[model samples]
Target chain A: MASQHTRTVFFISDGTGITAETFGNAILAQFEFKPRHVRLPFIDTVDKAHQVVRQVNHVAEVEGRRPVVFTTLVNVEILQVIEDGCRGMLLDMFGTFVRPLEIELGMKSNHRVGRFSDVSKSKEYHDRIEAINFSLVHDDGQSNRDLDEADVILVGVSRSGKTPTSLYLAMQHGLKAANYPLIPEDFERQQLPSALVPHRKKIFGLTIQPERLSEIRNERRPNSRYASLDNCRMEVAEAEAMMRRAGIRWLSTTTKSIEEIATTILQEIRPERLEY
Target chain B: MASQHTRTVFFISDGTGITAETFGNAILAQFEFKPRHVRLPFIDTVDKAHQVVRQVNHVAEVEGRRPVVFTTLVNVEILQVIEDGCRGMLLDMFGTFVRPLEIELGMKSNHRVGRFSDVSKSKEYHDRIEAINFSLVHDDGQSNRDLDEADVILVGVSRSGKTPTSLYLAMQHGLKAANYPLIPEDFERQQLPSALVPHRKKIFGLTIQPERLSEIRNERRPNSRYASLDNCRMEVAEAEAMMRRAGIRWLSTTTKSIEEIATTILQEIRPERLEY
Candidate 1:
């Protein structure tokens, strides 16, 4: 238990410790050393803070080493109390993060309180985007569905994650998402899907870094018409032009995770569908 | 904005801020008065924390009132700095929540420094459960070609959100998810799916609060055998007993949102399948 190799991180939050856990996990993934995690959720009072501090002190004493603390608190005084009692390092989530946003929003110091509605609304929008995308892939061409059915509808050339993205959207957001592949033929023909044209407002085109596309294609078939870099560039450019001509909005899927891409699309387009 | 009636919350975290936003939104949903939310993700340094504090101050100025701050920080000293700078109420997310877990685990407090190996392991266990449930649903009397294709599977009495949950899983996880409904006839005959019985290790059952089920059923049918409280209870108990007999693990879905239910199941049954 008292090894020089392992460190313990206490991830605490005002409500559920999930936020700290999620973010902390991602950061930890970036590190080579793995440490232990202690998560505590739903702490809104000073008494709770004191109890937690005592625990931290006990752990430090047993381990014979000072530990770092990563925390999110809703009360300032409670944090002070913990700091006074606990000798180890501590991290405050809100104090370090929200101050700038408050300034940007033109609010006074410590003026912002409570949960932002935008976050939930953004989630809702993302859900809708996912639903739309899922519906496009799994449409089976049978049912005429509502807008809520979409997670995201990706319009782009071959090799984009349209199919996989649509599937991911459905699996992640419970959205009946779908996708439509935008082939070179479609670009040559200068036609968008007839079904999508009416919902042009909902359409979002995906463009990739042409080099990446070429590399991805080369894996499937080298030196072929489909895998040529010049062809990839031409197709991507032409697709962008077609989207611009059609007055459809679009995003670049290059150098982004599926989650990031989906989240950005949801935030920018179809934001109304979000519950928050 | 100067609205005295409203309260504001700032949700600050060291990473994506999604978790804080999620739980915060849940709490906010309980209030009729919608509070303004400001979120800062990826606060890895004390400098970033200072920047956030400035933002909170600005919001306070704009609102012309002191707002409550709800924060999740990784550095305790930074929390102190923000508290010193701000006049509004402060809520420290970590001090309030995770300190106890450190004691329970008998581990030292290491701030913003740990690996979530346990979480990942738990996620793997959850994924296995979901996988088995998915297998039972999508078996389809044909060849079970891809067991890895599942995101989750739900086994329970009919009308337990099995189909909807399967659809949600498929739509959300890109998982070729499936659901196996326990029919009344099957319950009366005291039988389990022969195929599922073989893969009992993967099975997960869903049971609902009888009253809740009755209310949900009452919406579809004013008066019917299917909607009766007595019948619902009997079916629930019998189904649970059958699962226990088969050594299949299960969860109750009563009063949980589909998102909450799905998330809990995914976390408990298929922790390994977590994308993050």
Candidate 2:
């Protein structure tokens, strides 16, 4: 159950306010009380920062409580304005880390406003978009002919976290990722799918604990034999053995987030993927 | 061409380091110079923070200059340790935002360690995973039968940014997003696809400038009607008219980033999507 007492939280950033809110929610989720509400006000300049401070002041006054502000303002002047004008706690992200970084790095931050995809016209943005389109068309082995263009091919049983991992690799790393499911027949034959044999070197296998797999499958098709723990155990065991025999590198997705899984895969393969 | 003058940068976060790096890179990209290198060290405690301070100190000494740090640590003890231990300037995220938040929030933050997806079994974490899987399986109209379960169905012509936007909504917002393409046949008929009739309330249309759509499609199928600007323009015009006549809400993907597009869709539909 949620707590009765709640606090208002604002995640203010000069950018998307995504980073501010991510850390803010992560912190608030740990408290005994839930936040009364949360607002993400993307404040990109001194003018906007002052507007946010006023909003924070208004919220504090109206709620009869002090409001919580989590901000990622990079400009010292803008930050100063908020800190000076606001009557609440200001958790400034750059203030906390930038100075220490400046001392450690022996350089001053350029203090540029948060950069977003306004660079959609740029090559980097297009490359990522291209990769996503490639991934979508190549998804679930739908376009086998284009498989040769993929930097990585992820193969595993249905619902072995292949799709999200593929998309993650595409979105974050700009890698063209194509995924194929190891159907029951492939497990029965105890072989990698024939379409993948030519590109064996690029294949990465994903495995999950049978029990967890069963739980996930049950969510999709409850009470089915496919979701049975025994069936999941057998299929996963067979898939692992097949990949092992083929000398394909594999990772267990049982306990890994998509980020961890994607990072490990990137490290293992080193596909000249985009780092950002 | 890459720049010659460069410096080392570190993205230190008690959590995933994703947000810190996103902001860090955004700021860095604006400069004429490039980072010599970047490091992401996920430090979770006062000890780890101190360790980071030492590493940054070592980098400064070895490089004959201080290192720039972009960080998102939430605890004061950890921040204090890093600030005191390091010989460099400290940019404390929480140091700036938390105090302002505390005054307004009227309560002390629980000071809990940042919990990332490594604590992988949380409900909120699983919701994102589930949504990703749902989106993947339902991607590009893969399973028409399950369309009833989708939070939103993104409809647009091929190469109009529907897939990536749908995937972004799923990955970032824990939204079960299914996308359908408006094929030439649908345009010829000047009507919504019959399968999408029942889900009219949940449909969101994505449109792009014919020039951009032609460019994107040309990358896939060069010198063809599919990639021809004339065809793209005609198809897009017809699709827009059809969607407009059907009262389907739509957005242009030409000028906006995926983040911008997803945010607008969320605001328009309010599909119970997760904010963080």
Candidate 3:
């Protein structure tokens, strides 16, 4: 008989799956054979839980391994489905983590904690949640129409942190921020997005050193057009030129984290539209 | 004949203004009045630097206050611009923060440490930077088509750690993780983006409780449509229904930080397209 396979641990959860993923990854990183991870977010139903079990079984079959499912499910019924279906280990989210909190607080089993319920009571926490919300909704080219609705707009070249910056703006500032990439094509055309041109006042650009861009690009597509030095330089230069001509204010996204970019943009743009 | 007024504080920097914002906000939070903020990100030129000064002046004029500018400019020359234009207190970003860092590292003035500049030759550090780049490009609805191009994709509701999760995925996992908001509209339509539907295998979902949603929403709009409990319940239910019918795999966005979400998504999704 085959040796009992090392358990394939699934850090499943109902939401972002980051917590289980982080603790799970940290634990896995310690081991030589990284136990497999199967995370299922937004699993708020019995059917979904059943589906997750099927997927777990499939992964186990493919790897010829018995897997331990670590999950954070909001609905209790789904947990039952997962426990019943899977033969390997199972870690239920609420049961292991949240239940203790409920017990400690003496709150009901289904006590929910989120921004709206807690905002009036906690300004700092609310601001962080708002910051996260603002960041998630704000995207550059795709969400340009929504740009006007943003508290800030982050403009940057590829890999210059248009996305994370946007997230930071949302997560930290409680400001709605949208980000748009100053793509090679957009630069070649020498035009800001038509929507952005009118709102140039709100536009903030992010550029990084060509060398930095090269290093970042090299990691993805080494020696390719997407990550080439010449291409990056051209894109950066053209993007800068376009920002200059369009009169859209901009910033450089070189060495900063998302938090830095978002805060800076919020400070600079100060969009009146964000007066919620 | 007006008495001297409080100065507006501007935190301008080359990259994201998180550190400056945090420190600045911490200091400001100690104060009772809302301090004016002018943050310029991605500052690579004298012109942009000049614009920031102009904005700072505008704020001062409007508020009838001399603003204290807490800035982090990458280029020293930009500092000169702020100094020339403003009469308020100025805290240079690099001068204040990096000075300590430089002293600690025994590095020269010219030795600038940036996200692109590898701090150490450690694989972990290198991976973190790569992860940040990946998250920057991967916005859910805006850049989901790029999902196939992404190292990972994050799915979640508003404030469910999608943005942070994406950033964490990029900053830690070196995986390009694009995120999309599972909005009420999308759920009401009972459809995922046409693009995401096909990439169901790669999609992840994040769901938080309605009460939590209400808590988050109430902060922005005290009693608006967004913050309504009924709306929250409806949206969460719809999003879950949509996710289930699409047969797209998902994760919850509740009770996790950006770090955990990113890591779990990376392990579970494990997209074929990785960034080097």
> Which candidate has the top score in DockQ?
2
Evaluate every candidate with DockQ and list the scores: 0.11, 0.32, 0.07
- Across residues A137-218, which tens digit of lDDT does each residue of candidate 2 receive? 8888888887889999999988898988899888877789999999889987888889999999899999999999999899
In order, what is each prediction's RMSD in angstroms?
9.3, 4.5, 14.3
Residue A267 C-alpha lDDT in model 3: 55
> lDDT by residue for model 1 over A1-276, one digit each (tens)?
557446667776554455556645544443445566676554567888888888888878877777667666656686677778876667665555555435533554442233322322355534543454335335332333553445445678876655444544554444565556677677778888666666676667778889978976886699998899999999998888888999887777665545555555555564432322
The stretch of ten residues in a row with the least summed lDDT in candidate 2 chain A is A267-276
TM-score of each: 0.58, 0.82, 0.44
Better of 1 and 2 by TM-score: 2
Q: Which stretches of candidate 3 lie over 4 Å from their true place?
A: A1-131, A251-276, B1-126, B132-210, B214-276
| Model 1, residue A23: C-alpha shift (Å) | 4.6
lDDT (CA) for every model shown?
0.60, 0.75, 0.60
| Candidates ranked, most accurate by DockQ first | 2, 1, 3
lDDT per residue as tens, model 2, B1-276: 023434566777765566566656654654545655444444767778878888788877776656666666766677778777776545554445555555544667666645554534777678888778788777777788778888889999997888788888888778889899999998778888899999999999999999988988888899999999999999999999999999999999887777777876886776334232
Predicted complex 1: DockQ? 0.11
- Model 2 - which docking category? acceptable
Name the weakest run of 10 consecutive residues (lDDT summed) in model 2 chain B: B1-10
Worst 10 residues of 3 chain B by lDDT: B111-120
